[model samples]
Target: MDRRRVIDLEEFADELRRDPHPVYARLRAQGPVHRVRLPGSDPDYATWLVVGYEEARAALADPRLAKDGHKIGATFLDEEMIGKHLLATDPPQHTRLRALVTRAFTMRRVERLRPRIQQITDDLLDEMLPRGRADLIEALAFPLPITVICELLGVPDMDRAEFRKMSTEVVAPTSSQSEYDAVVRLAEYLTGLIEDKRCSRPTDDLLSDLLRTTAEDGDRLSAQELRGMAYLLLIAGHETTVNLIGNGVHALLTHPDQLAALRADMSLLDGAVEEMLRYEGPVHSATFRYAAEPLEIAGTLIEQGDHLVVGLTASGRDGGRYDDPDRFDIRRDARGHLAFGHGIHFCLGAPLARLEGRTAVGTLLQRAPELALDGTPGEWLPGLLMRGMRSLPVRW
Candidate 1:
């Protein structure tokens, strides 16, 4: 049998930074699973690309699959920087860590924040209205969710800017030695913060809840684990929502009819957000996973220890699944979309993300009815992991 062709990760990364759907279509046409060499890695390091909807979902749901980034020697940060966080663990361990925080991310907890989220959205827009022209990302998309997460996590108001900077550097598509250093620094800062929170009395916030939580055996998260969890939640919780709001707004502005329909009826808010997630999710690829044992997906065989990259963005747009998959329609039933991922590892923050998206986009439309893109939508962030514009200059 012929070995699957390698995808040029550098070229693919360039496409991802700009626009990747066309390239995704080409890869998807090849097969359900394609072998590819990741750029900046060893020549022998071949990873499986799961791009189709069914195959991506299957890979995510497969129990034999592992989310431990260390398994395949994939390290965005040094070993000291990782510290066995939920994103770096496989089942059993991942299950335990996730369960500890699941209640905090429940729909009820998210629903209770609707009023606060709306207030934050309104306040940000209030500040931007006078500017006439502002970068939606800086003024609204980025700060709104960061503020919300800080409030939810009980992070000190004064520390938010530092946290935001650290989070951005850690997750930016382009990472260098300095960026890895930033991750270490951020981890150290979070370790201190968690220690501080532990020493203080509990408060009415997620961090406080986490601090108070213990396993059935009376075991609580270690300092390292707590720091890791805090880092993951802070970054994932805010950054993804920022893109959802930013990307969703950009999508609407680019599609006038859809924007008009949404403005004409507020009931479409839920559907519109779903479409936004499906059309352009924050994470282009799901968090990296590895095959624990040999597995076969859609007739393609994957060996144990092989790296797997599930293309959430590509799978959402698979033509076989959605009619006119390229077109963005708020009316479409996008429930099956894998934007938040699938199975046991699906995003725990989906409710919060949706609430933020609706509050941000819905409020923007109501406030600036004549909102239009201020600059050419030519510049986008570069990365295979994330898909979003670097900045959205807009005017009322």
Candidate 2:
């Protein structure tokens, strides 16, 4: 622990949130890992930000840096509001949870969902493209994945705008009380949904399958764990992809050359999405992980119990990892970018996200050849965990 040299990140919180690449560049120039105070962290709690590509990648998969906070006497909002789920567990617990969830989630792979994803994209475009001008985030990006995840989880149609409001608050709260209320509401809703599923005849939804799933040893997801899984899936499932689409489109709109290249030859659509993820990923940073025990990262000591936040956005733009890192090129070989992360905690929804992005961007370009930015993005989501626009205005 470097008690004498702690970089306070709250000092430039605004700049960091709006455009973090410059800040990441400055920090990466200094070293791979640094002890710092995040914008909204507890003042007394120590935290480190890993920025270098190699170090950030390694730290993500390091066993010493455990995902379970309870092991080190720490806790996060998710554990308190929901219950312990995949991200909040370690070892045997995590292994068991991942295995069970994987059984349910991966059964329907990305290829199987291609037609439906394309249909969803086309439907959304049909509604929005005719309007000529609209907020892309609200019109297409947000709804596509939310609809998919909700249907997968068997959530009945309700007030989507309200749900969006609640989910957004949980991820990027304006106040602690707001976040608490949002989490409570979500907890109540999921509890009711789970109970409804319990009472009703079994369905093919993931949540329903989870309720019925049992391990070889007869272990099953408790009610609390079920709710946790649902909450994680509902929130993380759509939110990350929301940004991937919003950010990817934003990158293209900002860089017309790349957009034109994609429009000229749709074959680059897949690679373009990869570059978009590399250039401006939806996940700004990996969720908070604690050092289970003392560890060394890039020659710096990360004391036991200290928190680590690997800068996914920073690593994506690492000059050492890519030539002309800051330049956005659809043709770049962005195969190893940490956009979806790497390791046990790697996003299970990567294939789904890629499918959605490819379909969404490809279909939109095919339908709206004259699409152009109507105005600047409304406002970046207010958090380091998620990087997305609240509203992306566009005209076609």
Candidate 3:
């Protein structure tokens, strides 16, 4: 096989699972986009790669691109497992579903939860402080987001632990047949939870609110749709935020001077969070999208039905866009980075994610000013879709 072909297939997947930047840098130098073979699939399967910042933003915003997996007839999920959730829908339907939950995600609502979020952070940290040494992820980063999300969504106390277990299997790189079984179980669990909420009076929680929402035409979500919505919210809500906290802390610890700068100046918290998103965002690539029709982006013609994987991590590190793209500089204006994505499909939980990130990292610095890594920084999660330290063991 040709060296390029081999690199594009097997080696690329390995490199991507570890750290894709070096490979992405090489590809970006060639052009804004490239056609790469999709690993672990049929020989004919290939995905269009969007690497440049401009191209990624454009592709994400393009209406001709469809995010619904059923539209193109290829999916990593079972047909029944694929719900008509906002994240997997297009156009007017997507708009409608998103609007239903928009109010709960507003900045005001997120701000109101600040104290609660801080309390959650402090509570988790309280447990970690006495350990002398603890995995930041398990002790703090992972639990805080899961707990906050469970509270926000009204996930039953009985199901919260199971939910976390299934979520891990679903996102794990080496997930197998058993993992798929766990996903099905999770779906079933959510189905029951939704039904329970439907029978009961509504509450202030997100799940209850979703149950109460009706479209302008008086249409309500079907049982399947509700389950799907719950799944998306539960998974995306906690998983990504866990990474944001973990990745942000790792970034700061790796750069002592920057950490000191943040410690000295409390005002830099917001910018530091933004820098974390740009430097090592949780979601390495946006969810997949397919072209509904032929389109031209960055001088590359993408045909109808063609799959496109927006290199979000690569785009954030584009030297063409930032002066020192790789540097973890909190002072840099990293606002335009495509970490949460762009356009109509921009991440709905962005405000909440930011809030969680700010509280988690800020509380950590204050509580453990002497914090340092307990393991080598290179021991990190292996995946192309998400980037995070696997075991962030730390000591104050």
Work out the TM-score per prediction. Answer: 0.95, 0.97, 0.94
**Candidate 3 residue spans exceeding 4 A from truth:** 1-7, 76-79, 159-162, 377-379
TM-score pick, better of 1 and 2: 2
Candidate with the larger lDDT of 1 and 2: 2
Against the true structure, candidate 2 reaches a TM-score of 0.97
lDDT of 1: 0.83
Q: List RMSD in Å for every model shown.
A: 1.9, 1.2, 2.4
Which residue pairs collide in model 1, if any? none
Clash-forming residue pairs, model 3: none
Error of model 2, residue 10, in angstroms: 1.2
Judged by lDDT, which candidate is best? 2
Better of 2 and 3 by TM-score: 2
Indicate the TM-score of model 3.
Answer: 0.94
Evaluate candidate 1 by giving its C-alpha RMSD to the native, one decimal.
Answer: 1.9
Model 2: per-residue lDDT, tens digit, 1-396? 365588989887998889999999999989888888889878865589999999988988898898988888887776887898877887889898888888778836556778888888888988887778999999999999999889878899979999999999988888899998899999999999999999999998888989998888998889999999999899988988999999999899999999999898989988999999999999889988998888898889888888889999999999999999999999999999999988898888888888888888888888888988997788787878888888899998
User: What is the model-wide C-alpha lDDT for candidate 3?
Assistant: 0.82
Model 2 segments more than 4 A misplaced: 107-109
